[model samples]
Target: MLNTQIKYIDYISKVNDEIEKTNLPDKVIEKFQLKETIEAIEKVELLVPVIGAFSAGKSSLLNSFLGDKKLPEKITPETALATELRYSEDEHIEAVGANSDITTFSIDDIEEIKDRAKDFKYLRMYLKNENIKNIEPLILVDMPGFESPLDLHNQAIMEYINRGVHYIVLSSVEDGTITKSMRRQLENIQAYERGFSFFLSKTNLKPKEEVEEIKQQVQDQLEDYFDITNEIGLVDDNGGESLQRVLSKIDPEQLIKTIFLEDLKDNYFSIKEAINTSISASGKTKEENNRAIQQLQKALDETLQKKNNLIEETKSRYSDIRINAIVEAVSMDLSNSIEEIVSVGMSGDSNALSETILEIAKSSLIVNVKDSMNDISGEIVNDFSTGLSNLNSVMADFTISENWIAGIAETTKKMITGASNKLNTIVSERKKVQNNNEDIDKTYKAVTSVLAITTEVVNPIVEVAIVFLPEILSFVFAAIQENKQKEKIRTTILTTTIPSLKRNLRAKLPEMFNAQVNELISQIGEQFEEAIENKQASIENAQKEREEENRNMEQIIQTYKKADKAITTLANNTLYKE
Candidate 1:
């Protein structure tokens, strides 16, 4: 196996050296991601990403794993950027910036790193610790906790996906068996084929039976959603037996071989094929070239079909999550708004009630919907960025545009306008009641106006609610006629007002809010679909160009076939030995 690794590495190095010597068109070489593949093969470190919700003991677990308090542990969102712990002969921490510049600094510089977190893309802390020596080739990546900005967290994790980084997903039994945020992250990870192990951290905070229950729950949930090969375990901050369990579960040597072996084999075959194609250099008869092109065309069609399906699946998953999250938030906000309006109606000041309803609708309700829209938009942008990053190495001229952001912003404004218009209609109707004329008739008119709208928009059950409201108002009027005390009259009105208002709102508002939220969802879906359609066109064009390039290299294809068979045989032998 060692001989196989050496031979494979040597062959890949020779192929790259040959490519450089030939000095082929850079554009042609890049189309196959040959350069990136070479770099991936040359790198020795295996990235083990530690991810979880904020304050889920990721840093503590790492500190325990290293047998050193190297990472700052404050139970806060520490290590703002993605911080990495790698094996080094000499211990030190350095910050890597966006422009590929590195800064070596002392422990005191952590404050500055915190202050300028956004500026640094990653922090690499190299250490020579005895505890981590056995896992020398493994780089433990502690991500910015999921409690960070959704975009930031998604961005960090998506980079891991593009680079094929496996994960050490952490969750606390104390927080819950699983949370909505953790589920979302896990779903995103599951989109790609990779290895991951879950650790239920902070188990000392729970009883043994409870920990067992949590572990069972996690296994059930993950098995339903993911093909998790590595089993889940319980770990505490002290990290003793649990720590050993985690270490054994994610043994660095086995992990490296499992993740990289297949990937290395794939890239190895691809690079070898590229080399063979270059060596033959366009020397084939027209008939032979036509036959090869036909084969290429068929493969391209199947690849494109699978790519489209994957893209559609990703988009659908994202949209469902976005809609559900937005709708839930809007429903809660609208329910609260209705409750606030009902509470204010008890005062019997129609003017104050109207003002309160409008305040809640325009402020809290609108803000909730807008925030949801923004979150969905951010997610779309992140997805686009992720897709484009994967493509950029192969398609240098391809670029992603943020032009849809403005359009989404405009659509959200229109949705908010629709909501405001609905609220404004109610407020305007309230203004027309004549308080100066016969007071009881005027009050009755106002009550009936509200009831009319509610019953008209919702259901007939409100009729029972409306019946009670008129009688309550009539009793208040009678109290006034008898020259009853102001306090007594006010109390009498409230006792009836509160229950009537609640009955009307419970019967009416949920349906109305849900309809509005659904409408907004439809609008957002249209925008997302449009974005996806544009991306599909781009993928088709890229695939066509790739096919055309292959068609012109029929002789090269023949050579690649021979080279591929040799590598496949060697790869099988290595796998058999393992």
Candidate 2:
């Protein structure tokens, strides 16, 4: 995967080189900002945000998961800026200003840090915590309680929305409902490309039955009011098994995996679009190269006919075979990868699964498409280079924009890396689930759900990325002009013949490629969804079997009186005082 990333970076460098050679108008280059987008591929990180209203036990919940009172808990509606906690060798903090300057601070300066956060964009806390050791290379942001300071909430949303950041929406069970403001936050968070999980905080304060009722109510509210269908997990205020259960639901590794692939796919298509725009917008003259243009048209007509015939023949003979091959290969790959990870997770050893899935992500269709760009470029160049020496200069110039091939390659590499990081977070968080069969059951459900969601989110985008630039033939003809061809036979080719060729290739190639990719994605998605269903069914069957056994044991053991307490434990009482 890392090798692919390096190759991808190299590909981007090459594309930049091509862009420079083309000397595209400054406005076009600036409009696309292809260079900046290419550079962003490496810097992308999955933002896992924790957000909720004040006095909702948000800080307590995060502190419990980290096994330390890291975040400052407040009783009143004291405004706080967004704060990101990441792993570090030495504990420290940095305030990142809106203008991009950083101010470092010692860990002891709590008041100073708070003051800085008020004026700063966000504060980055570097902590060495054993609880989150497995989730290294993670950025867990704790934003100001939603609705605390309106501007801070908006700023947080605007700043991190596009950076592949998913959210953990925290709502207190004390209210037993979703508020209007909270619904608005949910709407905003769901608008991004990333997925989100709902966290019902202070679940321990209510009876188990009451807690379950609250969850149902919230889920129904989500469906009725917002039409959302996200999983909501219980976060015990006392930080026990319930807390672990909630943590298990928001798998960081899975988030990273999904977001990376998503971004990579987006980046690849954007580059293709930019290259196409640049080519279409290039300057052309009709009268100056009329003779050469006529010869070019005749040649292009002959060449396009041959190409079209070849595509049709291939489509007739090999289309089904290619589709089956792709579906079979990807299904086997995804099945093996998912099964292996599920097996490990069910065994209470999810840590080893990240590397395995990362390997699988490396071989996804988008990555494969990116990897194939160079060969595809070479093939197009070879196919067009045949039977004409007069058009070689033009063909060569057309091939220069093939630099976008590298850009595509680079995007896929980043996709895998991002997914790998998120997978790491999932595994790391899973470690908090103790080595018990009960926790293992929870692990199974969590891993299965994450895998299913990942498949659903990633499959369509891969299809799009693979088919984004179906035929490079359009850009290939834009550069074939000779200043010295006074009156060549192909001069008309530039105006009439080449445009027709472009239309034929555009019309045919995309249809063929799209059909193949759509079939591949559809087959894979079905197989994956079926696999998830089967696994879920098996787990349910096993649980039923266990319940039957437990019932028999309960009858044998005889009934005992259960203690009923008059006073309930308050969530705030157990929170770390700090």
Candidate 3:
């Protein structure tokens, strides 16, 4: 997997270098970058960094993994640094800096030692656990709160992530969804490294129902935005209650293990299959058999080009029919909605009148827009279907004469084999004379013998093949002529029809709507904007209400944070206890 990632990285780097020279599209470059990142992650061993907003129970989740309450103080109770846990027999914890300076500290003294100068840039503690020993070696790095007020603290965590294996994103239920800053950090990590997971921490802090709702919402949002289909794990401090619910949905440890093992197995099998196929194909002599293959490849390319031209021609012919249908549908819907709105406004009902008027206008605009879109979609589908049908018809005419080609290929093979055998026989007959370094006359005779056989055996076969060449040449010319005619028809239709249809559809709709439709559209636009502004005001009011709710929720956040800190502190103290 690592090898594959390295190859992918190198390939992408070379491609990017070329793209820079060529000034390729930004979207193409971005696509390459995304592919490179995903490939890189597939190779590296990832350490899931459980990160979140300050006091979001990131430490508590780490404690749960360790199966101990003794981790380290979270938030202000402990130095704002990342602490990683891995299996080790040694009783000491090692703190290493980005500068490569190492500091040894008793885990118990971590909280008491307030010397910021001596504080390590990164900390790793070895815990004596049978479970850790049995699983693939992984160190869980507990990141400081991503949104920590202290820049140095955040920078320290960021540095740790740059050097670390993978990330496990964490968030709290009461804290709302993961913040935008946290997401940006994750994106930054993804830019360089591939390994990361998301964890909704402190599920126990909220009710099961609320936690589930938050989890679904967060998962849906992440999947929609990041295109990640993996189940997002949720962590709870209380005996893994909510964590287990998430675990039931997705086992993080199992997933991590599978990431490497399954990928390695898949790559190994693929390489093996490729090697076997190459060896099997190589048995056929290139000199004897490749000419026919080349001819077939060339024929296929020509056929494809012809098919493409036919497809384009058909698309041009049918495109307008589909676009007109959709445009008519949209115009009708918009006109009806506008008429209804005008009728309602004429009635002069003022109570809820403003809301109703705005709603009607917005609805009319949406219907009209959707109808236009529908027409475009219908045109696209019709074009695609017509194109495919025409391509099939062209392909049908370009019949691949496999049997005739195969016979010629086999004849060429026989000629090469016969010549080779005659040469071998002559070489064998001259061996004794050549070995003695004597009998110059015999050696000359042997050389002449092989040359004569080659001229006689190979030349006649070539001559025979050459005789048939005129027929093949005639056919190739005929095919080229047919292809040219097809191209001319294709170009004529596309140039004359498709663009005109699009323009016509665009023009017909406004005419169909007339002056009343125009007035209604203008009214709808104004009402829709007014509705949006009203919605924004309502949302602001809701936000105020949410802030009040958060005041009540702050206690829960604090409770979870305290519980997390207590558990981590206990675990750290226990592990380092003399």
Best-fitting candidate, measured by TM-score? Answer: 1
TM-score for each candidate, following the candidate numbering: 0.47, 0.43, 0.36
Candidate 1: Cα lDDT at 528:
34
Q: Which parts of model 3 have CA positions greater than 4 angstroms off?
A: 1-46, 113-118, 149-151, 193-195, 239-578
**lDDT of every model, 2 decimals:** 0.51, 0.47, 0.42
Could you give candidate 2's per-residue lDDT for residues 1-578 as a string of tens digits? 23334444555565455545433334434433344434444444546777888777777877877778877887333458778877788999888887767988877876777755557778888889765555433467787775444344445644554343567778999988996557655654443335667878887788999999989999999888667786677887665345456555656544433444444345334434434332322222323233334544655465555445545554444344443444344445445444343443333322223223322422443333322322333333334344334444442332224543343334333323232333323443444444544545222211212222233333443333223322322222232222223223133323443344334333433454444433332322232232223222322322333345334423221211010010011111211111
| lDDT tens readout by residue for model 1, 1-578 | 23433544565555555555532344434433433334444444566788887788888888888887878777344346778887778777798876668988775566777777666667888778765666545567878787654334434654454333467888999876676457656754543334677889888898999889888888888877665645787787686456545655555456445534554553444344344433332343444434444433443354345434434454354444544453355334435455444444555554344333322322332333345444544443344334333333332222222242343334333333221121223322444443334552221111111112222222222223234445435555555556655655556445654444444544544445344333334434433333233333333333343456435344444444555566556556554456
State which candidate, 2 or 3, has the greater TM-score: 2
Model 1 scores what on Cα lDDT?
A: 0.51
By lDDT, highest first, what's the ranking?
1, 2, 3
Candidate 2 worst ten-residue window by lDDT: 559-568
Which clashing pairs does model 1 show?
none
TM-score of 3: 0.36
lDDT, candidate 3, at 493: 25
Candidate no. 1 TM-score: 0.47
lDDT of 3 by residue, 1-578 (tens): 33434443443344334334422224223322334234434434435455666677866765665567656644462366666667777755678865657878776766643345235566777778654454433445667664432333434543554345456677777766755445555654543334566777767677889888888888887877677777777676752344334333434344433343333332222222222222222233343223323433444454345434434443344334534554455334334444342333334432222222222222233333333433333333333233233323222212222232232222222222221222223344446447777544321111121112222322232233223323422332343345534444333223432233234445543333232222222222222222222222322322333345334434433433343344334423422333
Write the candidate numbers in order of decreasing TM-score: 1, 2, 3
